[model samples]
Target: MDKRESKIPLIRFPEFKEGWEHKQLNELLKVSKKKNKDLKYSKEEVLSVSGELGIVNQIEHLGRSYAGASVHNYGLVENGDIVYTKSPLKENPYGIIKLNKGVPGIVSTLYAVYKVKDNNADGEFIEHYFSLDANTNRYLRPLVRKGAKNDMKINNEYVLHDRIFVPKKEEQKRIAHFFNVIDTKINQLKEKQNLLEEYKKGVMQKIFTQKIRFKKEDGSDFENWDNTTLGKVFKIFNGYAFSSKDSCENGVKWVKIADVGIQRMQRENVSFLPFEFRELHKKFLLKKGDFVIALTRPILNGELKIAEIDDFFHNSLLNQRVGKIISSNNLIFIYYFLQQQWLINSIEKNIAGTDPPNLSAKEIDHIKVSIPKVKEQEKIAKILSNIDNKIAKSINQIDNLKNYKKALLQQMFCY
Candidate 1:
């Protein structure tokens, strides 16, 4: 531990000027070894501790019961109780601690349950101390021990005796509350994003089914839609067969079928071709407003990921198993139409039942559709696009807030 950490954290409240005192975990918190008393009948929420989500009710989260035959022998935990799952995780080798709140519940027997012994020793403060980058990547990592089954576990004695520097009770509460406020804001934004997405989905269904028809400019009914083959409106094109040797770090972007999904194009997993060979990939390069889909996955419920490429994804070369649809019709309208269940089912029926189902470019070209007139298509696009914009903005805001909190966790704690 750095000498400076013993005296103060990288950031702190202005009023707390004294150095924090170090104490062993056992001295600060008491182990809760009491077993569940409801042996006759278990009725409370069945809890489990996940290193990622912390402690949560298993049945509610999984949409079904994952609770063993019964949790009669499980450990009991109450509000403000701190629980630790002592199993190793790939990212967090020393296990993880979660402070349970809101209700009293029962966790599996295979966890360490404890209570704050010192009235001044806040559970939230301890949770933050353990979670901070300065402690996770630096202090706790080194203390993990190799145990039976080759799993990493911190020695019970070592963990119990491990010392941590803590601020006064009031200061600790303030710091914990600061993070809580941020968490509440993030959750609110997430709920807003979810509602917007659901609203857009419902609207799409209504418009496609003609339940909500678009009117002509003069407030008159538009002409009936005409049935037409997709080939007339779209020029279907399959991606190039790029070899492994063509991969490069700093080169032209090569978008594979897997790189594109319903959530939009994934930027991090994209591969590239040598910049010098950009000329060779010119014919395969994608442009803004191109409709693309993963042909290899065929079409399965929720497996169909199709989207219209925006300027952000322009100039990208399409790789094998991906197909792009170029058309004069509004690309945005075609993008959403492809996502409708009927179109997805039509595309799936063409697959030949190969190990991994695949779609042929010809099949995509020949599929028939009843399209709206150009004006109606544009109107539908605007409604859907507006909701998309709202969802996108909320998602971006949530991501930014998470990053901001992560930065604070790293900088505010002692090293």
Candidate 2:
């Protein structure tokens, strides 16, 4: 209990002054060898471990059971049991471990399940301890042996041999509870964001279908929406075919096909072109408030790969296979209409049977859409924009909470 001689977390509760004790995971947990031998759990109870979502119902998380033909050989996971998947993830290359807080489920043989040996250690605390990617990778990388196929070669029992620092049972509970509260807040914000998105989707459907309409400032009804092809109302200009040699480390930002996301631009791994190229590629330059869409693999999950240019990407040169939308009419209105499911379906139908699905300027220009008057368009855009602002705020709050939790994990645990 000597503060100077023992290991301690960077952050600790005032009531707990003692340093954390170093103990092997084997001393705290035992491998669960229980199998679903007697058909106790059905294939419907199959579970999967996600680095972000922890242990979740396989069918619910992935939309279908990736289970093998037989369920009899699956591993049984009881409530509070720890499960480790040998499958590598982008964040956790060695695999991931999670504690099952939901109903008892069965996982594939690829997973190794465990149970706490006694009340001396907390399973949730252990899960959180390994929550940080670096901490988990540091602990598992050395112990794991890779097979010829790059699969993890360690067995269930050997996985628990590593040692880790742990607090007393009381401190463990406190830390776990504190993280649980943060997790709850994050989940609530996520739920709110989801609901707001769903609400916007429903409202958009009603407004576009004319099930609902916006009245004029004088309380009079606006005219019916006009049906017209995209080509008639807007010009679809394809980006210039910039070569890889044009790419540079520092210069004008280049907007490639990969930069376009659903309603936003992805700034990660961004490429740049020489600043002077901005003048050479004047037609390819995207300005603030410009609407752009990916022409290569344009549709994903029933949504168009479209984004509105922001200040950060203003005057950025656009690369090939991405289209810039220009219209004299309400540009924001057109942007919102392009997001409609029906438009996406039409685009898909046009590109059906095509490999590496692409959307040509001609194809996009040919799609028909219903549009209201400019005033009504402005009203609709304002309404949708307000909802989007709320959704964005929720996303920002959730990300902040996750970052906060990540920071807490770094300090609260003895790495």
Candidate 3:
């Protein structure tokens, strides 16, 4: 192994005998707050932002729901610029900025951009260091204020005044290179995962719509698919309204729609309800294999369609606006089927809502579904389940790697 030393030996290379130089951010950088810039852009050139991945240029506002506004004010950003939102106080408030292809607009007023000092460091290298998980959380977390109306509000002064370790230029580049290699692998896997999901969604659409049919081993089509209402095939029930007044540390497990994470049901995030209330709402208790669907959401255009009730979440009861699928026609099959895009489109077409879109039991009952033989359904589920199993395993590995990298950074870098 190549030996390295510094205040922390692991942070610097062995060949590098120079001690780290501490410096104020402004002294080593040209800091430009987007809000303070005097730049302007036409509506056509206006850029949209989300967190730190600067200036989306597709002009395709294809989101799960509504798209956000465009930034048209004074904000200078180019390739390699580090951009971060400065208004909303958030748990982790910063990200390394990037200007995507086809993007031609200036930075949004929400960002604070930093151009590295030519005498001191490489801009890309600094951006990479700042993008490190530990640095982002360590530097930005404390800048957040609790009572701020916006979730994040970081000013230029706070960031500029914070003291940071400035390694020699060569070391900075080397460290950035190491992390960038790992990051590329992680990003590549993530893209594969996304593509696999899209493929599965497409397959689901074909199967449910009868565009593609599952054939029996005998080379014959499983009898003409029957049409059935979801209500008949599954038991749909509303969740219990656990009283906020009696909420305490030790109580029965309760879940809200918000408790459901993007891809999995967050059993660990569950809150406890009073025992009396739990007993009263016992009928609505969750069981493994049960599906929980978010019934109330303004963006009900089919996002967050389903969640399986895992064993860890057993005895948990759903809360108001969340729909529990107590029983179903082979849940494993239903789970994969609901994840299909075509099914989501169908649900969206039939969904009824006011200000906050809500899917009712009646509307759910009217949802048309292809009824395949239970055995065939199980078979199809198995095929898709294997693919998903691989995807989940890959994600777990990535999480472990990220955690390991975080731990390594903490040990190697000075906090």
Best by TM-score: 2
lDDT of 1 by residue, 343-397 (tens): 7777777665676887776766678878888788898888888889999999999
Best by lDDT: 2
Q: Name the regions of candidate 2 deviating beyond 4 angstroms.
A: 1-5
Cα lDDT tens digits for candidate 3, 180-267: 6877787787877788777776766677777877778888778786677666667668887667776778877777877665447765
In the predicted model 3, the residue pairs found to clash are 4-14, 87-152, 88-151, 88-152, 88-153, 89-151, 89-152, 89-153, 90-151, 90-152
Measured against the true structure, the TM-scores of the candidates, in listed sequence, are 0.86, 0.96, 0.79
lDDT of 1 at 341: 76
List per-prediction Cα lDDT, in the order shown.
Answer: 0.75, 0.88, 0.63
How many times do residue backbones clash in model 1? 0
Instruction: Rank all candidate structures by their TM-score, best first, as comma-separated numbers.
Output: 2, 1, 3
Span of ten consecutive residues with least summed lDDT in model 1: 1-10
